[model samples]
Target: MTRPSNMREWSARARAAGEAQAEPTGATLIRGARVLDPASATDRKLDVLIENEHIAAVGEALAAPARASIIDAHGLWLMPGLVDLCARLREPGATHKASFASEMPAAFAGGITQVLIPPDTQPALDTPAMLIRVQRLARQAGTLDVRMLGALTRELSGAALAELSALKSAGAVGVSNAAAPINDSRIARRALEYAKGLELPVHVFAQDAGLAGNGCAHEGPVATRLGLSAVPVAAEVAALRFWISLVEDTGARVHFCRLSTARGAELIEAALGRGLPVSADVAAHQLHLCDTDVDGFNAQCHVQPPLRTRDDRDALRAAVASGVIGAICSDHQPHEADAKINPFPLTEPGISALETLLPLTLQLVHDGLLSPLQAAERLSRGPAAIAGLDSGRIASGALADLVLVDAEARWTLRPERMLSAGRNTPFAGRTLRGRVRATWRAGRAVFRASG
Candidate 1:
């Protein structure tokens, strides 16, 4: 099958085929790539023929069409491009921190084709126009797909609910308050009820504000010794407990964001056992770093739901493997150089994650904690399911969003080499295995590594 030339024609063809597949500019033959589709439980050496941005066929030693471009992918691994559930592509307000122009390269370099942008910005994404503006910006940039997440509360203040239905109609995939904790349980419950009535998924960052007051690091020996206010693991557990009850009462679907503690995972698992409509994700950094990583007051280690103890980290790793935790995200917040000039306690919390997401994730695979397929699922299929997206699987009649990886390739992290404006990653100077060789969206090569 040939792909359509534009989205309109593509949609028409997709509707007729009962699938949403992008139309490529021409037929593309990817030969001898190890194709892995976690959603379909497929892992094998195969040849994939993409026509009009949709996969036309997959088999061994498939012959290429006469005019199709051939990409010799021997020894490389091909899979669906990643779908990120949480990331702050600072735009509309904090362009200096990060923007579409800067973040897209990082996203593409990391093999992420679609990223869900959070509502935390100067003018919160609370209105249909705001949501549309971000979409327009992404389209203008002409790179990866950027999905908008509208604010659950007006202005993300958590004081009042936003126009949920209108935001959805404006193309918001889901709603969230970002990291702004809703102190009023009543307002939170009402928001969930409204979302339930409209059948929208609500993404919540669980944290009890009062309990997490002025905290700059995890509440443990590290914070105690550093003389900084700490956010205890109990803060997350408390907020999750309250939110779980509301989810049960209102029957609203919820996705708990950045689950960092052992007890927190236990709460979500118990909720799932009872069949409450819920899912959860952990930050990739949380799985790899802990309170110990914050020693010497390394400002980059500061993150919301501040990295917990090693016990918590081990538990989170176990939860992800056991299927209790569905996804892993970069939580990719890019900060300007001066953002960390202040004292460690005063510096902002985040790590520049886009460039390092894949390599760091593959570390788990190297350690025997997660297989390549399992890790890819957390990065692609799992997050896509959480956001109700359509781009995280590869198959006939599906979107041609894919990435090719040199799974055993090694690279060193250097801030100057990163595409993002933020140079705040904790992994600088570290050697990481596995690197993206190329990435495609709708069968067009959007990013290709230089030799």
Candidate 2:
């Protein structure tokens, strides 16, 4: 397979030339905003000139040139569009529940320009043909740039490995099975070895299925008080330990998806310290809520590998702050109302996050837990690196996929106003800061706030 040459530098040069010639008529100048590019490690107030979908310049007082579209960006923050590592757009067979067309608008509204889709779709994305079909569908849907993670095992049964080489060739960014934990160590080892040989990253939803049982909530006081089945923390910890061992043995790139327990973070940290090629992410919901939030037995809080204790939440946040956790994903699993309106045990797990991910993450910035750059790292560059995409940067010549945000802007999350088909979000009516004003993909304005 041929690797695409880096075109970011060339993209910048083209933008500059276009702006120089067009500025005499008029240029679109985004003035006086704080620009943060995590990849470049740049954080400062700068004026950005965008001409024909490329960044013409990123410095102080660049003239708008003639006839340019002027975007007043005072009190705004401009950064690369976020790249979400773990998002579930239930398309193909489950379009009635959620579709790429619906999820794209929500993703763009939340400042996510690119997303790595899970392998849990209908028919399961276990083959190269399936991966290509999804990519084509996403392009036709015109929401956000969507890449697929091929299934690690055929049918996601965890009994037999899929064709990793064929899947990668078909444009699968990585391989995963969503929350389908691999129970057979031998099968898991074979998958890892194949991934290593292909140099493709393997995304593992680390959790011991047997230990998790029929648990509906975190194994803690809340579950005991509510008389709910509990999913022990050991479930996640044990699975992560086994995954780390496999990663070390095969030297395969492994990504632990949405780690929800404190012990999970500790194990990941220890593996990283031991120089194992491992990386992990935490869901935005898990980072913000604890098992205590499940007091009412709300199914919205009923996520798989259920939310953990307060100590676990704090530890997860610290892991993110300390750089042990590299990315923050929406894990944006969307379900219909019927799927979630039932009792906790019978209802499906997960929530809609495409519209809520950015705001909730910015809450971290508001509370002084992370610098804007750090937030950008987790929201953009980190995920891009994991997916091996040439995005998540503001360097000249990079793909002009970017987002303009008003970090100080505050608003209430109203599910009724969302563009997503699924309205099962737990953050409905919650107030949040930071809103995306405009989003560009491949040098085109795919989304802009209607005012």
Candidate 3:
């Protein structure tokens, strides 16, 4: 089904044109900026020219066209816009928590231009009609490029396999049962085989439901001290081991989502050693914050597959640094405030991430855990590769999806100032370095830092 182009009411074409007029004109030259092109493996000072939503040139001193805007990017780092592999922009069902309209702006504010939303929603994106509906809603929102993931099982129930071919035909980039794991290995193997035949990547949330068993926090000293039921590392490890065995048996491409345990990383590392076509992502929160953050009965830190020990967090950071982890996603699950107002265990799991992904990632750089180029790779190139999207690069003929950041700028997290409807972030009031100064998607400036 063709989406209605007129439904996009939030376009910034007119406003962007006005802003363009106020700036110097000449092929939108981004001057004196350090360019980081992970795809091209070029990290140096260069001027990039954008024309008609495509990168025209990149060099030390590129000439701009007579009628184009010139942006001064001195002391700024210019790189490809981030491609978030996992994010939940609740539109069809839970708009009160988040919508494409709200999430897109938040994504832009954090330097993201493309996002792959999971299938966990009201009607669920398991059918062609539902996938088309998501596409239409994304078009109407019109801020960032959105791709949908088809649910791996019907209604994400893990009982029956979804129509993989039909969902892919309807524009699902991949298939997943987000936030819910397939408890039965037989069922999981069947789903993997079906996805293998379709040559579609299957995204698995590696957690054994039986092991997780109504747990609300990570199983550790923190959970014990807080008097909360815990989700053990075995839940994640056992599921990963089963999935890895299935991958070897079926030759299916698998992408693990939000790997939170040290054992999870070890399993992935061993799989890579054996040459399996598998990749995994670590959420920014999991990489930085740990289960200890859940102290004092603060439900905001609650998460699915729950946060783990400091050692686990360190292991994830090391995995990213060692190249075992391919991508770093926001896993941007937004929940309404009231949903989180209850006591610890009953509160919803997830935290608002679209707005904080970039700043939090920059914190990794500040701590010397990740180089600037590695951070760019995890945030952009890697995620783009996982979704088969033609983005996350700065090259001739590449789409003009770019972000310019002031690496030294500092700011504090403010939930009320966020664009996402959900105000359930744990980063609230935390000061951080680095800031997204401007974001351009398809030659359009979707966001600019406030003065």
Per-candidate local distance difference test: 0.86, 0.82, 0.85
Off by over 4 Å in 3: 1-26
In candidate 3, which residue pairs clash? 25-68, 26-68, 27-65
List TM-scores for all candidates, in order: 0.93, 0.92, 0.94
Model 1 misplaced regions, further than 4 Å: 1-24
| Superposed Cα deviation of residue 17, candidate 3 (Å) | 14
Question: In angstroms, how far off is 299's CA in candidate 1?
Answer: 0.8
Decoy 1 TM-score against native? 0.93
Once all C-alphas are superposed, what RMSD does model 1 give against the true structure? Answer: 7.1
lDDT of model 1 at residue 59? 88
Candidate 1 residues 1-451, lDDT tens each? 3533443353344233311122346788999998888889888899998887788888898889989999999999898999888878887898657667667767887899999988987799999999988889777655578998899999998899999999999999899998898878899999999999888899989998889999989999999998889999888999899999998899999999999999999999999999999999998899989998989989989889899999999999999998899999989998877888789988998999988888888899889999878888989999999999876787888888899999999989988777666779999999999999888887777777878
User: Which regions of candidate 2 fall more than 4 Å away from where they truly are?
Assistant: 1-27
Ranking by lDDT: 1, 3, 2
Q: The CA-based lDDT of model 1 is what?
A: 0.86
